[model samples]
Target chain A: MPLMTSLHSEASSMEFPALQAVSTEVERATVDRARAGDQQALADIYDWYMPRVYRYAVARVGNTHEAEDLTEEVFLKLLSAICDFKWRDVPFSSWVFRIAHNCIVTHYRRTAQRGGPTSEIPLDMIDGRHDIAYAIEEQITMEEVRVAAAQLPEAQREVIALRFAVGLSIAETAKALGKREGNVKALQHKAVAKLQKMLIPVDGK
Target chain B: MTEFEQRLSECLEALVQGRLSVDECLEMHPQHADALRPHLIAATAFARTADQQPSAEWATTARQRFLIASGKSLQEAMDIEPEPTFFASARVRFLLAAQKLRQERSTAKPRRVPLFGTPMRAVGALAASVALFVGFSGYTVQSADAALPGDWRYPIKLQTERVRLAVALSADQKRDVQFDIAEERLQEIEALAYKGKIIGPGVLNRFVEQTQPLVEQANDGNLDAGDAARLQQVSIRGTQVLDQVEPQVAAGAETELAQAKVISDTGVTVTRELVVKNPDRPNIVITPQIPVSTATPEPTEAIPTDEPGAETPTPEPTDVPATEDPEATPTEITPGEVPTDSVVMSELPIVEIDDIKLHTLTAGRLTLRAPGPSTGWYLDGVPESGVPLLVTMKTQNQQSFIVLNTQNGDMYWYVSAASNNRFDEIQMRLTRDGQVFQADAAVLRYFYGDAAEIPLLVMNSIRILPEASPTPEPTATLESEPTPPL
Candidate 1:
């Protein structure tokens, strides 16, 4: 039988080109040295997590400018605390993700306080399938998916962003969201189920 | 978990990966096909959305920021230097303001005496015009600082504030400025709410849209410990503002009131997290901002008992948990809002959930029914699988196994490497730490690769709870009697 890792996550086959796992021996060595004050290694760590953090934050915030600012703040925070960051078995990406998650909640809270609109995923943020070969029905279907996802609870929305937007593993997602792996599974199931109900077109055309 | 549920989850995952046709999954799992079909389709559509990647220029800029900050910290540590005034953030602003003052003074031209017979009349007239100009400029600029939706000059205010942000030297300064501006917007929202304007939600929407990013920036790591307390103050101000909002703008509208309530509630939570990270004050309760007080309160209002702008000496880094700000402290909970312990939102939300899920994870057991002479059997733990188990049968055969992870309806397996009779029963795993997948049941089916025709299915519902793994007694997972490998 094929290895379970390959079949279980399909991380290698996912369409998101940027979801490269940082499990290489080189990454571990860099993290170790960065903790020890190696400047170049620290830069590498920033480069590695920046795209992931930005995509995840941007997806939740729904504004590019806001996401960029938040992403910058997250990196700077990482800069200040990198030396103090302890490396347990958890991947450093998960730690960065936790920061992103906190930032999103805090962002939402602040907006709510100011009496603001809740974030709905912005259409401009999603790339439309440009290949003319794809049909109109597919575009309509994709739009429905976005609207459906926008209505989910905060926890469920997070699961969708991490899984579809940033493409983290179940274990990594659990670490990032601070949920149990089983809990992530349950959330993933619930969110998809809701999206399914919402996205399906009424019986016939 | 029903078999259909498991298959549906697996098929959904596959559909998300673009690996399986939705029709195929629906056709194969007819029991839940209709229910699963739409979900799979949606998942497929969503998965096809291209993932975002930051522009390379952004990547370079962010990289440089990290390098600059990291390098500065390293140099400071190596030199054993006191805190360096690393950036001229304040001095630069002061210098710019001074230069503006000098330019204004030098540009002032002497006005010719007007046709009035008396010098006093001419002077008074000139003074009135000058005063009018100054007042207009001052009022306009000051209003820009507190501009909110519905104000005639709100756009001007937003544009001027944008100019201020463009000049900000550090993320911390930007965050502070953003918080200040957001506080103004909150005041405007509350004021409009008090007036019972039908336009209240629109204004509130603008306030939230603008302030949320700022709040995120404030909470993000750029702030010093002192600034964390400042952020808490911002949230408290928001809570007070929401109290105003509920009675007026959201009055008689249950949905609007509920939204206002959540906004205020979240503000308190953010405050608690910051307080826990940076406990600057001693024996102080994080009192909510009274509504009237929030109308014009400063965003950086220190603890109520303390002087404004007073910096609590940042404690030594050693005394602070690496997770928290060295300057902010958890203030005591007020007399009635919430017990201090309940407000301890803690570092992780999942920690609270984990405490409850383990009750369902009964202790899993492994039993060997049939014994063979000179056969060594062992079970081990691997890190890769969240619920990983390495099972080995050291008989003269190459063996692999598959486990049906009933919790999510996925199946996976691994082949143990050949080993001599070194370990009779090594530590095995029912589940991984930080990985609370369902704990109750799994069926391990063993296959003799190149040794047997049909696979041997050992179906046992594993009732495993989380184990301490401390005592030297028999492994918590081993059954009392060995079940045969029939």
Candidate 2:
């Protein structure tokens, strides 16, 4: 039985690389160090996570320059805020993205108060992929939808953005927004009704 | 909501997702036309906006301007707004005045050139001399083949002058040579920046402009060395700008290395001082963690005492009881010790080794589990598999053992040399405080040699007495009764 077990171990060992286990150990140690408020560890996390955040911000903000500024500002805020963050129920990725979402919403709110319509979506910063032309075309329609959405009550716009742009589920959206799931659903329905009335031309011309 | 509104909302969702059928879009009635019209127009406006790519340059420029305008009043910043009208008003007066001046210039045109030409040519000659100096410097470094750190700056200077001269030069035979020289200098500057020796914003900006075409060309992926050199130039230029402004950008590395060296050198000195200063922080109240035993009974707590001369105050364990084992038992009682009280332990089972796999972990905690009658396990004297056990490791003589336990997974054995009765348990097992561990295979292999195999049932028995004597006995007989703590 021992010989059979040894043989089985040998076979399975050949299939799994020992280095994979080592990497996981290293990653866990690094994450733990980061959680302990090691500045270097936090910086490393920033270095790895920045490019993705920058790209996402650029896609949303529609200007490379603003996105770059926003990325730096977001990271700066994250550095100060993360120390006090008690990650109770959400995944770390979700927490980071929530920070990003808050930053974007705050920026829009600030800009809106300054009297410019917060509608110019920065499509130019997106990577020029093969289907970029099609993506742009679709993006224009989405922007229009967003504009029509802007005409809806603020409650509806929040629900739609949370649902579509952030890809949060109804329950997750509710949790994030601190609203009931039913309220979110009703707002979503009302928002959609208003959007259709705004979008579909009554004259059909 | 009306039926039309519901249908329209569904269609809009589909539309936003790029899944709307043409038929579905056409199905909207005239009453909903106001909303549908804008959507259609906005959707079709894509063709016009397709080529309008967003660039960061404008935003960066705006931000820089905003920074500069920081102290200015709102009215002062708005000063540029009314400038268009100001210019319009000035234009009327200037046009009438310029007509009179033109008539005067026509009369004085021939005489003015001699005055203008001498000074203008002198300035142009001075610029040409500076350009030649820059060109010569660049060529001298390039021919030597040893890279000059400041060579890129010379080409940038030469290129700037070349641009000026190219604009100033008349249609002459030397015009093409001027253009070629300008282009060559631009390329050379790009190459210098690409190599990372050259630094600065003015020089870097020149390199960025030179490499712009190559960057566009490299979008096709079959970029030649020249194109790669150009892209490298732009990236290096970006880094150079960053380096100049923010020297702390690479804060982790150089500072960390310096601090680490300091810490290593002052290791014992710093430690001794910290201990002398805030002695309270290091003072640990370590209750000798009770080992899990096979004879399941009504759980009792044990108040552990401090070992030897450790500075930590050993708080009396709350509500512990005397050992109830009938076999070997603890002989000495530290008199006057507070009697430990009993409290029903709450099952706040913390997930030990969460966000991680316990068995494979080397740096984080490793969870050990005992082979069970059912599958639930225990840690300490408690029955809770999910309790998050604090993971810690000890390294001695170049070998490292990661020791930790959540409820079900507990390591309770020792290495062969640590045991006193070696003959009783032939293969040394890991110990939790002092008990035979029947944790998983990974724990067994990690604690003992790879050849070690633990018995399924008897392995979970306590080994309270140190294994000093090699008592020759069958494992079944040795593990029949719980060994009391000596």
Candidate 3:
């Protein structure tokens, strides 16, 4: 219910890169074709937001497979919902992510009902690419980021994950979370202030 | 937002995108520089975490599933709109997934499903072929390449790949070709993961073994950008991949995990060694990587590991350890031998991952071999087909076979689980983790080759005793044949 507060938030000082994101002329045409049952156009939409959707889902869900399943459910749900979606001032990207965020939240609730989700980072399928080994550093950083993120208060975590993990513009994140742009900014600043302690290099070396 | 705060937000966004330097950021807002620096640092790190790419397998599946479910309702996972939404302009009804469309119609009534953009007849023909695949096994091979694993032709598909390798001209050509094939293997794993199909450890093991040497080889030469980019993509992606794969390995593979680390640790040294001497070798192109040291620091040893994940400020490696021969064979040396070379320059701790091979098999394969004991060997009951599987297992007594169907990107879970015999320690280990075997271990070795060519594969036993030899070809002769049917 909190996420569905869908009326557009008032404008604020921070400019939303709304044009650069969801409402581009090409995107509008693609939406048009998608509504007309052009599968390719719908596929294009999947291509554009999949990585972002996945990043958000994975960070939120903490498992690739679960994240993937949730993402698929979100898209499938979108198929029925898309026709009814009249573009407000909000970006289409935000609407989809809102759906995805709800999907993940519902998943956690259901899994939690069954017992808490597995605490162990399910090390089930190993992917040891040579270059991926070099990315070991990035992976370690991400894991730490993941843990640190999980530790944040709910609102702060939402802002951080939406803005950073999903690569959303400030306004898009605000739209997706159903919050004012200024409120999103304030939450982001607080979240960063907290993470700074966690991420700072010791001894300043 | 005040003008200062507005500029501050822009600077922070730029910092997160890695476009603005911390000093330049501070310069823009001299008054708020100190207050904002720490937040900028946090934002930058979050940005880095966001930069991680989802596994290619996940990406491919997301697109296909969307295509497959074009106008479907999530409830029944169908596209047959009992009630269609009205469109203001000309509406074009694209054809649907036949399966979903079929389900939508009342089961009591049978009717022909019409095609829209693409012809329905062609798809119908393909469906008929798939149906035929189940009826006759051999008919599947010709169309096997397009088959996904679990399809009837998957075994022939695996055999087809083996046949291709058998005819390769030279060892160098074979290795190069194998590297290319390994990428295909990775794509396959991604494809399987995309479909939510079961990917066993064996399949991933094959790819891991294939790529280990390739990863090692990459460090010896100055990497071109394309190659470096490829390697980086694999390495970064491997993190999430490890999350998917590690639970499947039987415990004995702990030893295998260490070997993979040697390659990564060695890579770190070569990359560092080059950078340390960059003033001399300026022309050799390099990936702009700030190597993150994953090594445990010791008081007496190299303490200046990159320390990327933990920000504990260990001093940079100022001393270089004596060089151990980089060429020393991985297994020949003491297992998990920490590289001592950082003492020679700077004290960089040797950060080695325990087993990258075991991990990569999430996207690779498992190979089985036995040189001693029962020279006539079998995996999952099928007679061993390929030559000692070109892996560096400690001994021939224990082997892991990760059979993958070449036509399809699916893993042969049967082959992998077969190695999990009652006596097998690996099985015990897998059981210790939460992996439960879904199908029978007997399925592991049942070969589905040409009915004439398919050996009466011995079931469940890894070793084929001489008395029970199904096919009496020498190991050399077997080298020329394809992997026992996928």
Could you say which candidate leads in lDDT? 1
DockQ of 2: 0.02
Considering lDDT, which of the candidate structures 1 and 3 is the better prediction for this target?
Answer: 1
Candidate 1 on B1-486: residue-level lDDT in tens?
567668867785555444566676767788886666556655654554334555566666555444444444343323223223522232222222323322343346435544454446435533543432231233343344455566655655554454345334467656665776667767777666666664344555555655566455544644555665665566667767766656566434555445544554554555455544343433221111112111211224422332223222111223222332212212331111211111011121111111111001111212211112222222223233233232222233434333333232222333332332121111112233323232111111111122111112111112221122233435744556766699
Q: What lDDT does candidate 1 reach at residue B13?
A: 58
Model 3 misplaced regions, further than 4 Å: A1-23, A118-137, A201-205, B1-7, B15-24, B71-486
Docking quality band of candidate 1, CAPRI definitions:
incorrect
The residue ranges of model 2 lying beyond 4 angstroms of the native Cα positions read A1-64, A89-94, A108-143, A202-205, B1-486
RMSD of each: 36.2, 34.4, 30.5
lDDT value, residue B351 of candidate 1: 11
**Could you give candidate 2's per-residue lDDT for residues B1-486 as a string of tens digits?**
666545555544554344543234645555665454434333222211222233456434323222111111111111223334433322222222222323343465545456566556545533543443231222332232332326433433342333233233233312333333324534444455455543333433443343343333444333444333334333333333334433322333444323322322232222222322232322211222333344222113333433323222122333422332322322432232221112112132211121211111211112121222121222233223332443333223212222334222333333222322221122223444435333444333322333233221223322221111233465667567877789
Going through the candidates in order, state the TM-score of chain A alone for each one. Answer: 0.77, 0.57, 0.79
DockQ of 1: 0.12
Candidate 1, residue B437: Cα displacement in angstroms equals 82
Candidate 3 lDDT, B72-146, residue by residue in tens: 222122323433442211111223333333333324456655545234744663355344323222223335555
Task: Tell me the spans in candidate 1 whose CA falls farther than 4 Å from its real position.
Answer: A1-18, A118-143, A202-205, B11-35, B48-50, B55-60, B73-486
CA error at residue A141 for candidate 3, angstroms: 3.1
